[model samples]
Target: MPREAAPSDPQDLAILVIDEDEIRASIIEEGLREAGHQRVAVLADMRNLLARIEALAPDVIVIDLANPNRDLVEHLSHVSRAVSRPVAMFVDQSDAGVMEAAISAGVSAYVVDGLRKDRVKAILDMAVARFQAYSHLREELESTRRALEDRKLIDRAKAILMKLRGLGEEEAYHLMRRTAMRENRRMGEIARSIVSTANLITGDEE
Candidate 1:
């Protein structure tokens, strides 16, 4: 699955606290307020979770689950994947397998027995930082993949020009470069157009 990048504001970070227990939710809310976070929302149950999250559009999501079942954890993981927000999950206890699975599903920060009023701010900060880092890495990876694909396209286009026009490799490359410069387009774009045209003419789908 692809990761989404969301905007954040340190001064006024909108936070959503998900906890069934009213007392725990208040504690978390109090801590956030004490830390100067004014925009905060608390969800008591998992009903209409996605719709509420979409409506609120919080910058950070702090979920405090007491003895969460497998289905609940999986559902939260799915929500984390669907939403482009930083998720900090606090559980009373964590299992090794479940933790690994949740992390793989894109939960930003998972805490075991780490739900304290004083630590809420710090954990939220850490979750946002981790989410940003992961999004950056994903962008870099996608860029690299696109670059490699473009390189291959250029190579294929050059080979096609050389074969059809009986031109040398340097001549083919220079011709493509000249056309690219004239059209004010990128070399990769020019190369892709050339390859597409060749494929169309020759009926070579590959």
Candidate 2:
């Protein structure tokens, strides 16, 4: 099923503007307010950025870096990795490598020389869309990984049951299923318990 689109109304979103320069932060703040965003906060200092962000709990983050040094860029990368909020980074200039790094860091929007009040709303919208898409993909990937692990555990459990109980593969699987149903637990949980017990018993025998 197609995921629902993120809310487009700026009024509904809490925005955080991070910039070392007060003027630049004001510019971004003004842009957001003009776009009908009422819940906007600006931070000039970068110290304890993660902590501040945690306290603010903004839905979207706008970072303006006039001339980002290597350390600053790295800090932004860390924020990108740590924070799941939609991020729109505005930079004066950037090289190809830096752009690639920003994308790798999970930045939703990397705008170069695009810091106009009129453009802020559109950029924010784009950022939110990209963030949502990436989030969905990450969730799907994690779920697939977990499902594969569960299948492996179930297979190992089935093998143990077949050997220990002298039961056929189908019978072993049915036994686990019945146990899961009786306990109102997941099949994977039952499978994992069986595998763990079998390993423990085998180790003791040795």
Candidate 3:
């Protein structure tokens, strides 16, 4: 996290790291800390990446590009347009050369509206560093989320099964897990399906 020179509200300023390289990520995180940014979150695995970004309401977003992901570009485009935040990219229209330099360094930065160029450039060095860090964090977080979500879905599915089948918790969970595996789907997917079906059965949709 980068510490603020003057204390800013947590809602006022935040930075998110979205890189996948551990070593490079650390360097960026530490650099931001040294640069006086304290409100930072490293996103390792971003399951609902865009939603998380929206919830955090960060002042800036730094993404690490190992290769481009459609989800990322789409999210960025949506954020840049729909949300009040500023989404920076290395397009030929806006400072193409600087964007080129940044891409060469393996990072890109986006800030919210009303940030002056001079102020942004003042933090450019740190922004570049944080972009790499955030990317690494995003990958790690995503992995953790997958593991955690899997367990949660299993538990929820088990509860649903027990309620519906008058079976023990263990047996119910096992049934759902086996079904998920056989179907080549995630436990959450199965759980969601069960919920939807139940909703329909109970006439909750209307």
Candidate 4:
């Protein structure tokens, strides 16, 4: 999902922290306040995380895992998947490697969609930077799955042009662009239609 624009006031930013340790929570709250965020709340019980999140609609959330709570994972998954909300857990279900390590290491965060990367970077840096050397490396993998799917669609569209009109690759690409402009449709939509027509032809051939 696309991220929306940031709100006008950064000082009005709200944050929530869920941690069993009161001292740690206070430190995080102070750090956030010093960074110019005004509204900060901390919950010691994991059980209240979801309710607070829904009611307050905070800009960022930090969860410290003194005691393991699988419920937090379940809640993040729901928010990310169902409502198209941005939640930060290392195990982004959409990103498999991140998701796996996120699950194992037990740090979870959620950000409202379109929070500036600088803000997130600040929070993560404060939280993760001082960790002991032994716990430092998380799954350093990124997936190109979305890019791969886009390329496959584009290739399928090119094949359709080749088979139907005997056009070369460059010609086919130009034809797709021309059609997209004429119809006022996105290039991806045109590519998808081409792929669908190609599938029909292949089915007939088989």
- Report the lDDT tens digits of candidate 3 across residue range 1-206: 33334334333357777766556656666777776777777776657777777677666666676635434734664645666554654243456666765677677767665545644553555656556466667789998998787677667667767888999987887887799899999877887788668768878771
Q: State the lDDT at 164 in candidate 2.
A: 93
Residue 42, model 4: Cα distance from true site in angstroms: 0.7
Tens-digit lDDT string for candidate 1 (164-197): 9999999999999999999999888999998999
RMSD of every candidate to native, in Å, equals 16.2, 16.3, 12.4, 17.3
Ranking by lDDT: 3, 4, 1, 2
Per-residue C-alpha lDDT of model 2 across residues 92-179, encoded as one tens digit per residue: 2433544454454344333222234334446455434444455576789999998998899999999999999999999999999999
- lDDT per residue (tens digit) for residues 1-206 in model 4: 12235556666667777777666677667777887877787877666666556666667777755556535644664645654455654323454654344435444566776667655656645544322222432222122554566678888889889878999999999999999999998677789888887778678431
TM-score for all predictions? Answer: 0.46, 0.45, 0.48, 0.46
What global local distance difference test value does model 3 have? 0.65
Clashes of 1: 0
CA displacement after TM-score superposition, residue 140 of candidate 3 (Å): 24
Best by TM-score: 3
In order, how many clashes per candidate?
A: 0, 0, 26, 2
lDDT of each: 0.63, 0.62, 0.65, 0.64
The reply for model 4, stretches above 4 Å from the true place, is: 1-6, 70-74, 79-86, 90-107, 129-206
Candidate scoring better on TM-score of 2 and 4: 4
